[model samples]
Target: MSNDRVGFSQPQPEPDRQALGERLKEAREYMGLKQEDVAKVLGIPRSALSNIEAGVRKVDAIELARLAKLYQRPVAWFTGEDPEATSEVAKEVAHVARAAATLSQQDRQELARFANFLKSRAKAKATPDGR
Candidate 1:
């Protein structure tokens, strides 16, 4: 009855549960979904979802995959295994750039200037001395 094998003897390591929970919470909030809504889709209790987000419960692979699909993100995002997943702003900028590709060069330049103007205005507002 000895089932111990050389390669299978090592136990798997636990994941960073808190980080995973934070990513799940961020993804859910970014998608404007309520815990009850996601729980309904996952066929789990709302309290279970809350526990997952609070890092009090471990998320199984199937649940992670389901949440990734529900949040329009890859499973690696929830696991913190993908660098691109952490850069949501970069993704948004890439999306905007792709959409702008269809416009004329002049229009693109104008759009860039407008974007710069908005950014500078916001930066100025954030400064204490209003530089």
Candidate 2:
């Protein structure tokens, strides 16, 4: 008689934002720090860390750097800016862009108009001095 378990699950094709969130949470927990402890380590509030871990809030570069220092992890761990993530998102974006590039001149003009609108909206949300 023997007891064994083995099977290769199909790989997930998309970025798992939720699992990524949980992985960050688990890493924090493994460091033996509660949310408040992590907040204190980064000199922020518990609510901030809680919101971040819950994926309700986005993290900026500085905050990402602080988290990296506190967690004793490399900055790439938080930014997902490592080679792997960069290559993955880049490839997907390139795929979409190349397909769009085949559009006619008028279609490209309309797309540019929409992209400009989005850019303006993003700028409006920036700091007064303009980030």
* TM-scores for all predictions: 0.57, 0.44
| lDDT by residue (tens digit), candidate 2, 21-50 | 565686676555688777887788888777
List model 1 lDDT by residue over 21-85, tens digit each.
Answer: 88899878766679999999999999989878877778888999899998878888778778986
Q: Measured by TM-score, how close is model 1 to the native structure? A: 0.57
Sliding window of 10 residues with minimal summed lDDT for model 1: 6-15
TM-score, cand. 2 vs. native? 0.44
User: Which candidate number would show the highest TM-score if scored against the true structure?
Assistant: 1
- The residue-level lDDT of candidate 2 at 77 comes to 54
